[model samples]
Target: MSKDLEIGKKIKTIRKEKRLSQSKVVEKLIQKDINMSRETLSKIENNNRSISAIELKAISEVLNMEIGDFFDEEEPEDLVTFFRKRNFSKESLKEISKFQDMVRILLNHEKIYKGE
Candidate 1:
Protein backbone atom coordinates (compact mmCIF):
# COMPACT_ATOMS: atom_id res chain seq x y z
CA MET A 1 0.00 0.00 0.00
CA SER A 2 1.01 3.58 -0.48
CA LYS A 3 2.58 5.42 2.46
CA ASP A 4 -0.45 7.69 2.86
CA LEU A 5 -2.81 4.77 2.87
CA GLU A 6 -0.59 2.91 5.29
CA ILE A 7 -0.58 5.81 7.71
CA GLY A 8 -4.32 6.16 7.39
CA LYS A 9 -4.81 2.48 8.05
CA LYS A 10 -2.58 2.73 11.11
CA ILE A 11 -4.68 5.61 12.37
CA LYS A 12 -7.91 3.71 11.88
CA THR A 13 -6.52 0.56 13.44
CA ILE A 14 -5.22 2.38 16.50
CA ARG A 15 -8.48 4.23 16.95
CA LYS A 16 -10.46 1.02 16.74
CA GLU A 17 -8.07 -0.80 19.06
CA LYS A 18 -8.69 1.96 21.57
CA ARG A 19 -12.45 1.36 21.18
CA LEU A 20 -12.98 4.94 20.08
CA SER A 21 -15.74 6.08 17.71
CA GLN A 22 -15.00 8.45 14.86
CA SER A 23 -17.12 11.21 16.33
CA LYS A 24 -15.48 10.75 19.71
CA VAL A 25 -12.05 10.96 18.17
CA VAL A 26 -13.04 13.99 16.16
CA GLU A 27 -14.40 15.61 19.29
CA LYS A 28 -11.02 15.20 20.94
CA LEU A 29 -9.31 16.79 17.96
CA ILE A 30 -11.81 19.63 18.00
CA GLN A 31 -10.57 20.55 21.47
CA LYS A 32 -7.16 21.07 19.87
CA ASP A 33 -8.71 23.22 17.15
CA ILE A 34 -8.31 20.63 14.43
CA ASN A 35 -11.92 21.29 13.41
CA MET A 36 -12.31 17.96 11.66
CA SER A 37 -15.63 16.39 10.84
CA ARG A 38 -16.55 12.72 11.05
CA GLU A 39 -16.58 12.67 7.27
CA THR A 40 -13.04 14.03 7.23
CA LEU A 41 -12.02 11.24 9.56
CA SER A 42 -13.60 8.71 7.25
CA LYS A 43 -11.73 10.15 4.30
CA ILE A 44 -8.54 10.02 6.30
CA GLU A 45 -9.07 6.42 7.40
CA ASN A 46 -9.86 5.44 3.83
CA ASN A 47 -6.86 7.36 2.52
CA ASN A 48 -9.04 9.57 0.32
CA ARG A 49 -7.56 12.64 2.04
CA SER A 50 -4.26 13.70 3.56
CA ILE A 51 -3.52 14.84 7.10
CA SER A 52 -1.39 17.80 8.11
CA ALA A 53 1.41 17.44 10.63
CA ILE A 54 -0.47 19.57 13.16
CA GLU A 55 -3.56 17.43 12.73
CA LEU A 56 -1.50 14.26 13.12
CA LYS A 57 0.18 15.58 16.25
CA ALA A 58 -3.13 16.50 17.80
CA ILE A 59 -4.55 13.17 16.74
CA SER A 60 -1.63 11.39 18.37
CA GLU A 61 -2.23 13.25 21.62
CA VAL A 62 -5.91 12.41 21.52
CA LEU A 63 -5.13 8.81 20.72
CA ASN A 64 -2.56 8.71 23.54
CA MET A 65 0.21 7.78 21.10
CA GLU A 66 3.55 9.30 20.30
CA ILE A 67 3.73 11.38 17.12
CA GLY A 68 6.37 9.05 15.71
CA ASP A 69 3.97 6.19 16.26
CA PHE A 70 1.98 7.37 13.21
CA PHE A 71 4.98 7.41 10.89
CA ASP A 72 6.49 4.22 12.23
CA GLU A 73 3.87 1.68 12.99
CA GLU A 74 5.01 -1.54 14.73
CA GLU A 75 8.07 0.09 16.25
CA PRO A 76 8.40 0.55 19.99
CA GLU A 77 8.74 4.19 20.99
CA ASP A 78 11.66 5.25 23.17
CA LEU A 79 10.65 6.71 26.53
CA VAL A 80 13.06 9.61 26.16
CA THR A 81 11.74 10.53 22.73
CA PHE A 82 8.22 10.20 24.04
CA PHE A 83 8.91 12.57 26.96
CA ARG A 84 10.62 15.11 24.72
CA LYS A 85 7.40 15.66 22.77
CA ARG A 86 5.78 17.20 25.83
CA ASN A 87 7.32 19.88 28.02
CA PHE A 88 7.06 18.38 31.46
CA SER A 89 9.23 19.41 34.43
CA LYS A 90 12.28 17.28 35.29
CA GLU A 91 10.65 15.81 38.38
CA SER A 92 7.54 15.14 36.34
CA LEU A 93 9.65 13.34 33.74
CA LYS A 94 10.91 10.87 36.32
CA GLU A 95 7.40 10.11 37.49
CA ILE A 96 6.11 10.01 33.93
CA SER A 97 8.84 7.60 32.88
CA LYS A 98 7.89 5.19 35.63
CA PHE A 99 4.26 5.34 34.60
CA GLN A 100 5.16 4.99 30.96
CA ASP A 101 7.32 1.96 31.72
CA MET A 102 4.44 0.27 33.48
CA VAL A 103 2.19 0.96 30.52
CA ARG A 104 4.79 -0.40 28.13
CA ILE A 105 5.07 -3.60 30.12
CA LEU A 106 1.35 -4.12 29.94
CA LEU A 107 1.27 -3.37 26.24
CA ASN A 108 4.09 -5.78 25.58
CA HIS A 109 2.29 -8.45 27.55
CA GLU A 110 -0.82 -7.88 25.44
CA LYS A 111 1.16 -8.10 22.22
CA ILE A 112 2.73 -11.33 23.35
CA TYR A 113 -0.65 -12.79 24.25
CA LYS A 114 -1.95 -11.77 20.85
CA GLY A 115 1.03 -13.55 19.25
CA GLU A 116 2.18 -10.40 17.46
Candidate 2:
Protein backbone atom coordinates (compact mmCIF):
# COMPACT_ATOMS: atom_id res chain seq x y z
CA MET A 1 0.00 0.00 0.00
CA SER A 2 1.04 3.58 -0.55
CA LYS A 3 2.21 5.56 2.45
CA ASP A 4 -0.75 7.89 2.40
CA LEU A 5 -3.28 5.06 2.09
CA GLU A 6 -1.54 3.17 4.86
CA ILE A 7 -1.71 6.18 7.09
CA GLY A 8 -5.29 6.85 6.12
CA LYS A 9 -6.33 3.28 6.80
CA LYS A 10 -4.57 3.40 10.13
CA ILE A 11 -6.35 6.62 10.97
CA LYS A 12 -9.74 5.18 10.06
CA THR A 13 -8.99 1.95 11.87
CA ILE A 14 -8.02 3.70 15.07
CA ARG A 15 -10.98 6.02 14.84
CA LYS A 16 -13.46 3.16 14.51
CA GLU A 17 -11.68 1.15 17.19
CA LYS A 18 -12.18 4.06 19.54
CA ARG A 19 -15.81 4.48 18.40
CA LEU A 20 -15.14 8.03 17.27
CA SER A 21 -16.70 9.68 14.30
CA GLN A 22 -15.30 12.59 12.35
CA SER A 23 -17.97 14.84 13.83
CA LYS A 24 -16.88 13.80 17.31
CA VAL A 25 -13.32 14.78 16.50
CA VAL A 26 -14.55 18.07 15.15
CA GLU A 27 -16.57 18.56 18.31
CA LYS A 28 -13.48 17.80 20.37
CA LEU A 29 -11.50 20.40 18.44
CA ILE A 30 -14.30 22.82 18.98
CA GLN A 31 -14.07 22.19 22.71
CA LYS A 32 -10.34 22.85 22.54
CA ASP A 33 -10.89 25.89 20.31
CA ILE A 34 -9.04 24.20 17.44
CA ASN A 35 -11.21 23.90 14.41
CA MET A 36 -10.87 22.14 11.07
CA SER A 37 -13.49 21.66 8.43
CA ARG A 38 -15.05 18.23 8.00
CA GLU A 39 -13.98 18.33 4.37
CA THR A 40 -10.40 18.82 5.46
CA LEU A 41 -10.66 15.95 7.92
CA SER A 42 -12.11 13.79 5.16
CA LYS A 43 -9.35 14.70 2.77
CA ILE A 44 -6.71 13.98 5.37
CA GLU A 45 -8.31 10.61 6.11
CA ASN A 46 -8.76 9.76 2.43
CA ASN A 47 -5.13 10.51 1.56
CA ASN A 48 -6.24 13.18 -0.85
CA ARG A 49 -4.03 15.74 0.92
CA SER A 50 -0.97 15.46 3.06
CA ILE A 51 -1.60 16.26 6.70
CA SER A 52 0.75 18.84 8.20
CA ALA A 53 3.05 17.95 11.08
CA ILE A 54 1.04 20.10 13.47
CA GLU A 55 -2.18 18.45 12.34
CA LEU A 56 -0.67 15.00 12.69
CA LYS A 57 0.51 15.81 16.21
CA ALA A 58 -2.89 17.15 17.10
CA ILE A 59 -4.57 14.08 15.65
CA SER A 60 -2.27 11.74 17.55
CA GLU A 61 -3.04 13.56 20.77
CA VAL A 62 -6.75 13.49 20.03
CA LEU A 63 -6.62 9.81 19.14
CA ASN A 64 -4.62 8.96 22.29
CA MET A 65 -1.69 7.30 20.56
CA GLU A 66 1.98 8.04 20.10
CA ILE A 67 2.60 9.59 16.70
CA GLY A 68 5.25 6.99 15.84
CA ASP A 69 2.85 4.08 16.31
CA PHE A 70 0.54 5.47 13.65
CA PHE A 71 2.92 4.36 10.92
CA ASP A 72 2.81 0.66 11.71
CA GLU A 73 1.14 -1.52 9.09
CA GLU A 74 -0.26 -5.02 8.94
CA GLU A 75 -1.07 -7.53 6.24
CA PRO A 76 -4.57 -7.81 4.76
CA GLU A 77 -5.96 -9.06 8.06
CA ASP A 78 -7.87 -6.65 10.24
CA LEU A 79 -5.83 -5.66 13.30
CA VAL A 80 -8.76 -5.79 15.75
CA THR A 81 -9.39 -9.31 14.52
CA PHE A 82 -5.71 -10.20 14.67
CA PHE A 83 -5.31 -8.84 18.18
CA ARG A 84 -8.39 -10.78 19.20
CA LYS A 85 -6.77 -14.02 18.15
CA ARG A 86 -3.60 -13.71 20.21
CA ASN A 87 -3.95 -15.66 23.47
CA PHE A 88 -2.93 -14.09 26.74
CA SER A 89 -1.38 -16.34 29.35
CA LYS A 90 -1.08 -15.88 33.09
CA GLU A 91 2.14 -13.98 32.55
CA SER A 92 0.34 -11.64 30.17
CA LEU A 93 -2.66 -11.23 32.50
CA LYS A 94 -0.87 -8.73 34.70
CA GLU A 95 -0.09 -6.57 31.71
CA ILE A 96 -3.59 -6.91 30.27
CA SER A 97 -5.07 -5.85 33.62
CA LYS A 98 -3.50 -2.45 33.07
CA PHE A 99 -5.96 -1.91 30.22
CA GLN A 100 -8.86 -0.09 31.86
CA ASP A 101 -10.77 0.56 28.70
CA MET A 102 -13.78 -1.67 27.92
CA VAL A 103 -12.80 -2.77 24.44
CA ARG A 104 -9.22 -3.39 25.47
CA ILE A 105 -10.40 -5.62 28.29
CA LEU A 106 -12.69 -7.56 25.97
CA LEU A 107 -9.97 -8.02 23.38
CA ASN A 108 -7.54 -9.16 26.08
CA HIS A 109 -9.95 -11.79 27.34
CA GLU A 110 -10.63 -12.88 23.78
CA LYS A 111 -6.92 -13.44 23.25
CA ILE A 112 -6.72 -15.41 26.46
CA TYR A 113 -9.55 -17.76 25.36
CA LYS A 114 -8.22 -18.10 21.84
CA GLY A 115 -5.00 -19.52 23.30
CA GLU A 116 -2.82 -17.16 21.38
Candidate 3:
Protein backbone atom coordinates (compact mmCIF):
# COMPACT_ATOMS: atom_id res chain seq x y z
CA MET A 1 0.00 0.00 0.00
CA SER A 2 1.03 3.60 -0.50
CA LYS A 3 2.64 5.39 2.42
CA ASP A 4 -0.13 7.97 2.45
CA LEU A 5 -2.77 5.26 2.61
CA GLU A 6 -0.92 3.51 5.39
CA ILE A 7 -0.74 6.72 7.35
CA GLY A 8 -4.43 7.33 6.77
CA LYS A 9 -5.31 3.89 8.04
CA LYS A 10 -3.31 4.62 11.17
CA ILE A 11 -5.29 7.82 11.67
CA LYS A 12 -8.59 6.02 11.23
CA THR A 13 -7.49 3.27 13.59
CA ILE A 14 -6.44 5.70 16.26
CA ARG A 15 -9.66 7.71 15.97
CA LYS A 16 -11.73 4.59 16.27
CA GLU A 17 -9.66 3.27 19.13
CA LYS A 18 -10.31 6.52 20.91
CA ARG A 19 -14.06 6.27 20.09
CA LEU A 20 -14.03 9.60 18.31
CA SER A 21 -16.30 10.39 15.40
CA GLN A 22 -15.45 12.73 12.57
CA SER A 23 -18.15 15.18 13.59
CA LYS A 24 -16.94 15.14 17.17
CA VAL A 25 -13.43 15.96 16.05
CA VAL A 26 -14.75 18.79 13.90
CA GLU A 27 -16.64 20.13 16.87
CA LYS A 28 -13.45 20.26 18.87
CA LEU A 29 -11.73 22.11 16.06
CA ILE A 30 -14.65 24.52 15.86
CA GLN A 31 -14.33 25.24 19.56
CA LYS A 32 -10.80 26.40 18.85
CA ASP A 33 -12.18 28.67 16.09
CA ILE A 34 -10.50 26.51 13.50
CA ASN A 35 -12.89 26.34 10.59
CA MET A 36 -12.67 22.93 8.96
CA SER A 37 -15.20 21.27 6.76
CA ARG A 38 -16.36 17.75 7.48
CA GLU A 39 -15.27 16.61 4.03
CA THR A 40 -11.83 18.14 4.47
CA LEU A 41 -11.41 16.45 7.81
CA SER A 42 -12.52 13.13 6.31
CA LYS A 43 -9.99 13.46 3.53
CA ILE A 44 -7.26 14.08 6.06
CA GLU A 45 -8.28 11.19 8.27
CA ASN A 46 -8.43 8.97 5.19
CA ASN A 47 -5.18 10.32 3.82
CA ASN A 48 -6.92 11.23 0.59
CA ARG A 49 -5.26 14.64 0.74
CA SER A 50 -2.03 16.03 2.08
CA ILE A 51 -2.51 17.67 5.47
CA SER A 52 -0.96 20.99 6.44
CA ALA A 53 1.21 21.52 9.52
CA ILE A 54 -1.32 23.88 11.12
CA GLU A 55 -4.17 21.49 10.40
CA LEU A 56 -2.16 18.60 11.75
CA LYS A 57 -1.44 20.48 14.92
CA ALA A 58 -5.12 21.26 15.28
CA ILE A 59 -6.11 17.64 14.85
CA SER A 60 -3.44 16.41 17.23
CA GLU A 61 -4.47 18.91 19.84
CA VAL A 62 -8.12 18.00 19.45
CA LEU A 63 -7.21 14.35 19.72
CA ASN A 64 -4.97 14.99 22.69
CA MET A 65 -1.91 13.69 20.85
CA GLU A 66 1.41 15.13 19.80
CA ILE A 67 1.74 16.59 16.28
CA GLY A 68 3.88 13.69 15.12
CA ASP A 69 1.30 11.13 16.16
CA PHE A 70 -0.33 11.40 12.75
CA PHE A 71 2.77 10.29 10.90
CA ASP A 72 3.59 7.29 13.03
CA GLU A 73 3.83 4.02 11.12
CA GLU A 74 5.19 0.54 11.74
CA GLU A 75 8.26 0.39 9.57
CA PRO A 76 10.15 -2.75 8.63
CA GLU A 77 13.42 -3.61 10.36
CA ASP A 78 15.43 -2.97 7.21
CA LEU A 79 13.91 0.48 6.81
CA VAL A 80 14.70 1.23 10.44
CA THR A 81 18.30 0.21 9.82
CA PHE A 82 18.44 2.42 6.74
CA PHE A 83 17.11 5.47 8.62
CA ARG A 84 19.45 4.74 11.51
CA LYS A 85 22.35 4.72 9.08
CA ARG A 86 21.20 8.03 7.60
CA ASN A 87 21.15 9.49 11.08
CA PHE A 88 24.92 9.84 10.88
CA SER A 89 27.15 10.18 7.87
CA LYS A 90 30.90 9.54 7.60
CA GLU A 91 33.05 12.75 7.99
CA SER A 92 32.67 14.55 11.34
CA LEU A 93 30.97 17.68 10.09
CA LYS A 94 28.72 15.70 7.79
CA GLU A 95 27.82 13.41 10.65
CA ILE A 96 26.96 16.36 12.87
CA SER A 97 24.89 17.97 10.13
CA LYS A 98 22.98 14.81 9.39
CA PHE A 99 22.44 14.05 13.07
CA GLN A 100 21.23 17.58 13.73
CA ASP A 101 18.60 17.30 10.99
CA MET A 102 17.66 13.84 12.17
CA VAL A 103 17.32 15.01 15.74
CA ARG A 104 14.81 17.60 14.61
CA ILE A 105 12.79 15.24 12.42
CA LEU A 106 12.97 12.14 14.57
CA LEU A 107 12.13 14.00 17.72
CA ASN A 108 8.68 14.45 16.20
CA HIS A 109 8.66 10.92 14.75
CA GLU A 110 9.55 9.39 18.09
CA LYS A 111 6.89 11.31 19.94
CA ILE A 112 4.26 9.89 17.58
CA TYR A 113 5.74 6.41 17.74
CA LYS A 114 5.53 6.48 21.50
CA GLY A 115 1.94 7.81 21.23
CA GLU A 116 2.87 10.55 23.68
Model 3 has an lDDT value of 0.74
Candidate 2 lDDT tens digits, 26-72: 77766666678777788878888777667777787889989998776
Estimate, for each residue in 11-109, the C-alpha lDDT of model 1 and write its tens digit. 999999999999999999999889999999999999999888888899899999998887755587677567767776788788878888898899999
The TM-score between candidate 1 and the true structure equals 0.60
Better candidate number, 1 or 2, judged by lDDT: 1
Predicted candidate 3 versus true structure: per-residue lDDT over 1-116, tens digit per residue: 66567656766777788999988888998998889888887897677887766776777788788866656556654433564576643465456666677877888999999998
Question: Quick one: how many clashes does candidate 3 have?
Answer: 0
- Cα deviation of 115, candidate 3, in Å: 26
**Which candidate's TM-score is highest?**
1
Which pairs clash (backbone N, Cα, C closer than 3 Å) in model 3?
none
Q: Report, for every candidate in turn, its global Cα lDDT versus the true structure.
A: 0.89, 0.74, 0.74
- Highest lDDT: give the candidate number: 1
In angstroms, give how far residue 114 of model 3 lies from its true place. Answer: 23
My TM-score estimates for the predictions, one after another, are 0.60, 0.55, 0.55
